[model samples]
Target chain A: MLNIVQRFMKRLVRQFFKKKKKVKIGLYGPPNGGKTTLANRICEDWLGEEMGSVSAIEHETREIKIKEEISVKSGKKELKFNLVDTPGIATKIDYEDFVKKGMSEKKAKQRAKEATKGVIDAIKWLDEMDVVIVVLDGTKDPYSQVNITIVGNLAARDIPVLIVCNKMDLKKAKKKKIEAAFPQYDVVPISAKTGKNIDKFYEALFVIAG
Target chain B: MSLTLQFVPYGEIENLDSTAKVNKLIKIVKEEKIILLEGRIEKNEETLLIKKTMEEIGPKFKGIELFVMYPKDEESDPIQRLKKSVVDMLLGNRQGLTIIGPATIVKEIRKDPDKIQLLTKNLSKRKKTPASRSKSTKKKTKTKKRK
Candidate 1:
């Protein structure tokens, strides 16, 4: 059929262009998992700028933001990639949750609408990523359904993954739990807020990207 | 006011493809029923299921909570593992349990190596009496006036 041939041509073009461009490193995780904080950390370390804003509220980064031409170095080796900061993926978006956080009902409804679209966008962007950094709140259980879904999608795509167990500065942050949950992937514990063990994260990035 | 738990055996959905299987599951969850599936789906199917759930989110239909529990092969002996592989090849992997529920009802689904614990939301807390509603409204008005 004409549609099948067109699809094949499109995929071929995408594959050819993918090899020509810089590696796209994506930050993906559940809502409020400190993805934007990690994005800011990476951008500030390399470009002396922040990618987006961070908030205590969930779904704060409800759009996909990208920082191009970020070249990370570990000793003499350097890896060049475009760092993509995606909205936190979630299965549910309730306006009442924002209202409970002291947002007006009208504003909460608007946020919920945007968040729903954000989740869809995040999923759609999964296929375009060359590498993904899955950020998890270290204090929470890593065996949640959302975490499994995110990791499973990456595995299915055969994309290299690096799981960052963030918020290590918190007393309740148990790095072992995340390690135990996902033994297949390399788990690096870091406090994105404090930049703790972030060097190790960059070091591990080279290994995975290689 | 009521909760429904739908038990679906593997035979019921064995013939369906991945998209069909996810669609069937989402259709049930959209009706606010918790599904206790006999066997676990593939990893890619789980991802597809989440994508479909996000697409269907709305005011009334929130989303779904999914969990799967299976026996760990690491704990089994080599012979036992071989037997499981053979059986799995013959009859599919029907040794695991999958739970999918509407997020409006299921608050969380916690799983360890051996068991699954499903925590439901407290629906009673959402019901407000007329007197309590009026009292809260009056408190809000007083705060607005003070502001």
Candidate 2:
């Protein structure tokens, strides 16, 4: 009787899991482009929990933060999405800021070099992701080095990419030039800070995920 | 003794006082004849020089600790293996890094000044003068002409 009960329990757990499709997405952009803000928003909305820290400091996230095994309800079936958040990709650092802020020159230089490695390592994550949600800071110029490099690398690989033009809540956001600069991309302008247009963003992702 | 020369990336040179200070405190390795020579580069192109040094020595040195002193990036984990290597190299008691005598190291570093300069400029640490790449390309032309 105990053996039958154990077998029944095993079957129950297996049945509960059911059939689910995993959608692996890599979220990337230049450092400070609000990649984490978006990732946190997604997890919080879908999973009702804060997954990571959202900071304003440049390269605040020095490591590739992964929020995996996220369960989202898609119609009648259950879906799983693995989201990987990576460091920003700013190739240049304003050394003057480091000095004025009382940051040691050595530490600043070391940090700048670090930002580069973090970016490169993050980009490498693209090869493993099913889709790459490349974040963009609309407040900054669209023709920045990190943006160009990220888009260029994505195009070369032919990976499915979606440009998340975040920070729309800021008055200085310029969406047109960003679209003009990269005419060939599917760009979605959303404010990760204010949660504007997030539902639409999720809807687009669901279609793509399907 | 083997000589070891350090060419820190230009982006990294701004903290010369810190990098150099930290570097000086490290114990020098003597087994692989390690001599650590260092210079603060201001040009980005000089990075190519540093990467070249790693590529050249990386093969013979087997593991990076044997020769690379500042090869690890700052973003690496404080407890990871690579960071430990950097600390080991900086502290001068190279667990795996071989120390060449300074005299021997200087000779090795000076052997290819022109080649080194070319690779250094490729690093883009210095100002991107339009002529940087052309300058090296000119040398290639001369070599081709001689051939």
Candidate 3:
């Protein structure tokens, strides 16, 4: 009877938190910064599936991808939220560049138009984000305009943010640069490609989302 | 490392529509050169430029880097306010320029207190020079090429 009562109390607490409004978590970053890769990692770990495809090509995620009801557990604490993987934010997109990548002119132009729409949509979607994870390539300079924009937008919206300095598996990955770039927020260095130091990411997410 | 800097000049804002201006900007950026844009584009125009620019980028071009500077204003329209916040988010770390390209130079557009700055660092000497100005003479060349 004691064990049964304990299980009953746990269920009651779970249901109570579950009844609260769902939190929306957005993954935003520049092209090839591992936003989708990190989303895939989170989804694979919790939801047992992939979020979207990743590519070396720029703007591979030309659309906003979403997964709902992702419950991440760290210790006894459980945090549930929706994961939104936005298109890579960029200042410019050119089809001629795509043409050089071996794509036909027509297809490249089509991609350009879609990617433009995707960026606008991603910015618009910012209103809906409850919490955001600004992912960055740890090997690259964290002070780029794209990185600044992601953080600025989040701050403007008064949304809580966690900076994920991704690609730590690379020999050149520097987590300090990212931390130095935004000293106000928490920065987690992880490799979404190789799943390195992901547990810390989960712990960070729990604190931000909880 | 020894580097050759290419400077792409901006045109009159009154002359070109957002799309035309962005298209021209993309063309210049495609040459793997840094291009500077000033008060010619507004908040919406910048958004449109980003949209159009991303659409044209391919595997060869890799990506384009943007740096912007705006006066710190306490009073702005809702949209302007949002753009400022967006700009802050996009251009978060402001120190010196950062390089993230080689295949195509369309990299680094910076704005300053009084003037706009661009640094187009071409990594591969594969492409021929396309009527670009040297880093030292960027100011003079920009004045000479102005519309």
CA lDDT scores, all candidates in order: 0.87, 0.57, 0.73
Which model is ahead, 1 or 2, in terms of TM-score?
A: 1
lDDT by residue (A122-176, candidate 3, tens digit) is 8879777778999999998887766776787677445789999999999999999
| CAPRI-style grade of the A/B interface in model 2 | incorrect
* Candidate 2 reference-contact recovery: 0.00
Tens-digit per-residue lDDT, B77-141, candidate 2:
65787666667556432221222222212222211212221111122343334666689889999
* TM-score of every prediction relative to native: 0.87, 0.51, 0.63
The candidate scoring highest on lDDT is: 1
Candidate 2: lDDT of B44?
23
| Clash pairs for candidate 1 | none
> TM-score of predicted model 2?
0.51
Identify the runs in model 1 with alpha carbons over 4 angstroms from their true place. A1-19, B126-147
Under the 3 Å rule for N, CA and C atoms, how many clashes does model 1 have? 0
